[model samples]
Target: MTTPFRWDLVTPDRLGSMLDGALAPEVGYLTELCRCAGKVLARGGNGDLVFVGRSLDSMFDLLGGALEGTGHRLARLPLSFWRGYDYSRAHVLRAREILADLGITPASLARRARPVTFVDVVSSGSTFRSLFTLLHDWITEERETWPVIRRKLRFVGVTSESKTSPNTFRWQQHADWTLRLPAASVVNVSLDRPTWSYFADRQRKLTKSFGPRRWIDGPAEIDRDDKTRQALAEAVRLVELGRAREVRRMIARAMEGEPALAEAWLRTLRSRLS
Candidate 1:
């Protein structure tokens, strides 16, 4: 039997003309990012998984929807560990407190003998490295476990492709930095060249339009914006109905209306997705 259409399998190329003029530029970009990210997760993920980060919650939902028939079990650990922030004593204590509250004891993780993949978005990879260290210490000091607990761990990072040197092996660099794990254990779902450039341009524009802090903190603000919420909801509805063609048409029409933005969006998408 043929597999049914799922959002995880959707990519910018597949969206085709739907991304042309049918939806707003920002909406189209967000939809494409979520779809591409979902595709990456579905392709690279293995065994049982724990996904971390608040910004990724929506993308995880898309992934979960696509993974409906797959046997993988997924858990969300909503710990907000900022990449460049200093780790104060209070932060360490709070992390321990949260781990205790979540009942992530060594016994619980080891009970089923299933490997656990840790999923997150990576820039510098400091968050996952810190998490690995914290978990290692906890398993050693509190649970009094050794190599067995460590063996069942894997890390997956969803990141954008490099702009300066587009063909560089970015994942390997990330893997080298992640502690106590083989480079192979780190899986990256990097956005394709066009998508990554488009994203970087958007970030630069947002920063210039607002400020550096606004760019850094945009996800929260975008999430709370009513228009963004509605646009995302509409995109989800279209995917559920398998109306990808309609989405394409909508994007085409929207781009036609705003020729300047449409020109830039399509130009970038063409360079990458083509």
Candidate 2:
């Protein structure tokens, strides 16, 4: 079998700087765009103004000041994300929640009888695409003036994809180095591969790369407990061997079902993946 997709790792300091640089500009970019786009939006002098996407309360607070200044109202779209999960439910709920909050009712939004501004706080733009796609399809079905509504909506914040064309909205990157998989890496992982092998390799590399940071504590400090250390080591192995399914099981077994260890195991996995 081919070797797994091992990341070209960097120190935590380097990672932090990269993340900061990538995400910092988005605040200004969104602020400018919202100011410019506010005029076109149907917010009756209150059509409907809502915030959709991840990190609701924080994004709300950031944009709330500007939105009120422009005579706009605000509603939040709550989202729930999972490890290795793609955007779907979050996208749908955001649109629905906004429509509901505006008193448009689900049937009206579904019917295209009302115009509303769709604002997305995007990190990678996947959720944005998903949201727009649903809106587009819903609008088309009603045989209404879809362009009018589409024109009123705006997407703000960070995206990860490059600008392949004018229509592309790039997700802002925070790290100096973009994580990329080597050309042959996917070949090493397969549905048939045993889970143990995956976990083993991940453990081996992560320990070597990240040093002994706490495995189960505040914002990820290196831990003093042998059990925490052992659990992290085992989790890395599962990931490496394409055994993600078993990593949680192994952690539970090792920690005798300790919640802290379980959380630490997940966070460590996220750090490695992130």
Candidate 3:
């Protein structure tokens, strides 16, 4: 499995962000994003967060920065499960191997008490559905404790912010496979429209799409054009923002209203953040 070529910003391998000094960025969206991140963590019981694909890279970076020194977990899957691929047995095996590396195999799932929550920006929730199918089939084939493993799996979809109503289309409710998971295993966090489009459609990611076609290829090759460079700089800034004391406090405070706040685990974490 080929990994992406992302910079190790935490390690300070780069000299500068390469952004213009004179340009002042409007950052009203950050507060909302921190709230969303906090909700994602609280909803997942603050378990191991594994963001799926590039759409939520900003959130991943933000949380990664905030939780760097803490015991909280953060990771990115980078796997594009957009379907329509005729994956060979070898391809499937390789994909499973990658998942196993992340301690996501059936045995590990059953063994570990902590839930692994996969985060992603969703529209139709096709990516999440495809991922669930893959893991479910693998667990079935391996004859593992599906009952236990299912409980340790979770999904947080970042959907577009909208007016709340009874007719609002929720993907988890519409999906048949969600019935297999324990209640509340699949949840959602919403983002404003502009910010949602920024991540989902406009941002030029530093890594190439890790789709079925590129699994066996060499290290991820990404373009180094001006747009991508600008995006990279913005990403670096987001990471730094996440590391700020106020932002961490914001994250902690944002979890106050979540249902998980009643749990001792979350309260302990909130105390630590404060």
Candidate 4:
């Protein structure tokens, strides 16, 4: 019997569309940047604070070279909300979740005495303000350990966010320097631009390696059972045509009764197939 499941990866395009509605054009630069760097940052990190407040496009360009320069050691924070929802609530909640996953709470930082850098695709100062406030309290409470960890606190934001008020005050007042998009250039394109670009990029690779586009348009709803199965079947067909090694490995893992692995593959299938 097919195992029960009801989740799918929201494409970067979908994420962009969702974000366009949630934040003003200015605040959503980070979201666009996230689409370009999300997969990479999720999979890689370099141990240096190199740039801040740069455009999403420029940030992506720099990600690889910076990693290479730093000997492939880096840390990244890919801020995201729930799938297809880019609300600030989702953003803040996701940020907290990532921090929790890293065990990098304010209180924890004081005790560890490790300088931590916050890196993202966009820096509006607003986003970092809330994040930094949380850190500040944690550092303040743990005065004894503050010195050990204080020097380690750094932030690098890509792209521009509204600089209104004290948004990212710490970066302005405290950070070494904030790298930002140069004036006269479009700092942030429409939120959906990067997402669509990433999808187009992936689609091009898949099309080149396999055959023509067959899914018609992306699925309207992935919540239903039939859609999920239909989606996976399409993915299996494409993977077969492309002989995608990783997809085959996942299919093998699923066949071996690795429920989590199976679910992940299924989710990816749903996303790619859609």
- The most accurate candidate by TM-score is 3
Total backbone collisions for each predicted model: 15, 29, 0, 13
Better of 1 and 4 by TM-score: 1
TM-score per model over all chains: 0.56, 0.33, 0.92, 0.32
What tens-digit string does per-residue lDDT give for candidate 3 at 1-274? Answer: 2667777666656635455542444466798889888888888866799989899888887887888777888777877875667777777777787788777899998999788999999999889988898899899999999988888999989999999999998888898999998878998888888989988998778788888767666446666766677777777788888889999999999898788888998988777766
lDDT of 1 by residue, 76-176 (tens): 66565655666666556556665555456666656646567777666667768778877877677766554576656777776776655666656447444
Which lDDT tens digits does candidate 4 get at residues 1-274? 0111212221112222222222221222333433434332322122233222212323333333322322333333333212233344433444454566566766665555334555544433554554565456545654646545555455544433334574534334442222221121112212254444443232211011110111122112323244333433333333232234443233223223223223443344323322
Give me the candidate number with maximum lDDT.
Answer: 3
> Which segments of candidate 3 are over 4 A away from where they belong?
12-28, 218-220
lDDT of 2 by residue, 74-160 (tens): 554432223244435544444444445556443454455324544443444455545455566555655656435443444443222
TM-score of 2: 0.33
**lDDT of the candidates, in the order given:** 0.49, 0.33, 0.82, 0.35
Candidate 4 lDDT score relative to the true structure: 0.35
Error of 4 at 222 (Å): 8.7
* Candidate 3 CA-lDDT value: 0.82
